[model samples]
Target: MLALPNYPGDGGGLIVDRAADAPRYEYASLNDCPQVHPDSPNEESTCQHALRDCPPEELGPLLRIWRRTVAGDVVLEPWDSKGLTCASDVAPGARPTLTMADLKAQFMRTPWAKPQVSSQPKGNITLVNLTTFYRVDWSTGGFAPGEVDQSVLRGIPVRIRPKLVGFTYVFGDGTTYGPTVSTGGVYPKGDITHVYRERGEFPTRVLTTFGADFSLDGTRWDPIPSTVTVPGPVTTITVREAQAVLVNH
Candidate 1:
C-alpha cells in the first residue's frame, strides 16, 4: 500500500487517495495465539502469523509417550553392549497404536532384560594344564602318607585354577604340601613331577568340580582351596648319587 504524493498546504495542491489494506502485515510469531499470547511482555516477543500448529518429535502427543511403539517395520537401536538396540524410525499419527504386543512390551524395559537372559548360562572354565615328564629318583623309595607314587617323575612348573571341565583334586597339607596334581578340562597348562622317595612332611591340596551348570560369573568364580607343605627327608640321590649330591653340597 504505497501511493501518497499530493499535498501543498491546503490551497496550493490537494490530491491524495490511499486505501488498500495499508500497513497490513510482516514478520511475527513467537507464539502469539497460544490463545491471545496471554500477558506476553517477553513471552518470546510474539506477534502472530496464523500460528502453524506444533507437536512433532516423531508423532507428537508429547513425543509419542517417550517413543516405544512397536509393530511392523521395526528398527530402533540405542542401548548397546552387545544387546543390540532396534527401532528404525517410523512414527506417524500415533495415539494408542503400537502392536506386536506394544513392541514386546517395550522390549522388556530394554537393558537386555529378558529375564536376565533366561537366568544366566554362557560357558567357559579352563584351568587344567599339566603335561608330564619324570625320571625322579635320588635314591630309594618307602614313604606313603597318602600314596601317589605313580613312579618317580620330574617336570615341575604347576599352575592351575578354576578353569572348569572335569577332574580337579590335589593335596599336600603341612603349610600345604605339593604334588598330587591332576587338573582337567583337557589339560594343557604345564609342569608335573613328584619324586620324594624319602620325604618327611607333606600337606598340599587342591580340588575341583564346581560344575552343576553355572554362569552368572559362575557364582563368583569360586575355586580357591590351595595347600602346599613339602620340605624334608629326601636323601635318596642316585643320578650318579645325585651328581654326588650336587657336587658334594
Candidate 2:
C-alpha cells in the first residue's frame, strides 16, 4: 500500500494497494495514462485496469489523486495532467517565479480607493475666472503611497507593494491637469487649483496611477515592470458669472 500526498484542495490523501496478481504497467508521466472517455462502453474498466496495475514509480511523483466512485467501485485518476512534478526536478530553496505580467494582473484586481475630490469656496457653485482650489481628500481614500498585499503562489509566500506614481485631474469641460505627484492641498495653499474661463457645469475627477514592487519568500524587494491606473469618482462643479448689486448702508 502506498499513500500519496494530496494537493491544496484535494480534501484527503489517496491510499493505493496493488493486488498480488495485478499486471504491471509503466507510464513515464501522467499524460501517458489512459484518458477516460465518458461515452465509451469500457470507460471505467479500461482506465481502472491501468490505474490499478500501474506502479507508483512508473507514474513519477504524484501531487494529487482524484478518486471517483463508479457503480459501487472505487476508481482513481490523476488530478491534473500538468500538476505532476518530479521531486528531483525542483531545486531546494528555489523561489517561485513572479513575472511582471502576473504582478500587473494582480495589481489591476486590487480594490484601490478612488480619488476624493474637494474644492474651496465650499459649494457646488464657483465664479467664472475664479481660482477654484481643488485637492484630494486624503482621509477619504485619496492615495495609497505604500500599500501591500500578500498571498501564496505556487506554494511560496509572495508580497506585493504599490507606490503612487502620480495623479491626473480631469476638470471636465475639456480640460485636464495632471499626472502630477502632488495630492494638491487646501483653500489658500492648494497647488491643484483650476480657474474656470467660461462659466457652466464642469464634471471633474482624478485618476491615480501606481507602480509596484514584489518580494518572494520574504526576500528583498524587486520592482514590477508595469503600472496601473485607476479612475476616481466624478464630482460636478457648477460655475456661474458673479453679478455685483448695489446695497443701502
Candidate 3:
C-alpha cells in the first residue's frame, strides 16, 4: 500500500497495490479528473501536466520546476518536453528553493536574438582557391548591453542582465568553428573566417551563448553562473573550384 499527497493543493495522488501487482493514479479534486489505470506496459500515467497556462497560485512547487525547465536551467528528464511537467509526480517538500539562476531564467521568456553575421559573398559560391572571410555584426538583438532591470522573485526583488558571451559557427561540412568574439571584423580579412576544401553546397549556422548576472537588492551583481545557447538562422554557401589564368597579348 502506497499513498501520496498533492502539493499546495490536495488534487492528486498515486496508490500502488502491491498485492494486485499494479499501480493506480488519482487526482483528488482537480477538474473532476478520473483515476488513471494502466492497461498495458506501453501505457503510463505519471503526474505529467502542463503548467505554463496554470494559475500562479496552483503552481506550488511546480512553479520553480516549470521555470527551470522552460529556461533550460535544469537537467531535463528523458520524457520532458515543452509545456510538459513531470515534477508534478513528485511529492511535496521534494523540490529545491528557486535560486537566482531560476529567477533569471523565468525573466527571459525568449532567448537573446541571433547575432547579425555579415560577411563577403553572403550567398552561394566560395572560391576553393581563396579563403572565405566571415564576419559577424553583433548589434542586431534589441537587448540592452550591460543593461539591468529589477524584478520580483518569490516576493523578493532582484536585478538581472543578459550578456552576450560568444558565438559558435557550424560550417555544416563535418567540421565546426567559432566560439569567437562578437565584434565584426574588417572586410576581405575577418577574424571569424572559414575555408572550404571541396566544391559542394553546405548549410552553415551560428549559435550564440549568453551568460547572465543577478543581484538580490539592485546592488552587487552576482553571476548566474550558467550560459544559455540558442541557434541562429541558417545560411547556405556553395564552394566551387576556380583558377586565375594568365593572359597574353
Tell me the tens digit of each residue's lDDT in model 1 across 134-173: 2111113422122111211112111112222222222231
Model 3 lDDT per residue over 15-70, tens place: 34233322222222111012222222312211112212233433322321111111
Better of 1 and 2 by TM-score: 2
| Candidate 1 residue-wise lDDT at 243 | 22
Superposed model 3: Cα runs more than 4 Å off: 1-98, 107-110, 122-124, 139-145, 149-151, 182-184, 243-249
Which residue runs does candidate 2 get wrong by more than 4 Å?
1-98, 138-143, 217-219
lDDT of 3: 0.50
State TM-scores per candidate.
Answer: 0.16, 0.58, 0.52
The candidate scoring highest on lDDT is: 2
lDDT of the candidates, in the order given: 0.22, 0.58, 0.50
- Tally clashes: model 1: 37
TM-score of candidate 2 on Cα atoms, chains taken together: 0.58
What candidate 1 gets wrong by more than 4 Å, as runs, is 1-83, 86-193, 209-249
Q: Can you list the residue pairs that collide in candidate 2?
A: none
Candidate 1 local distance difference test against the native = 0.22
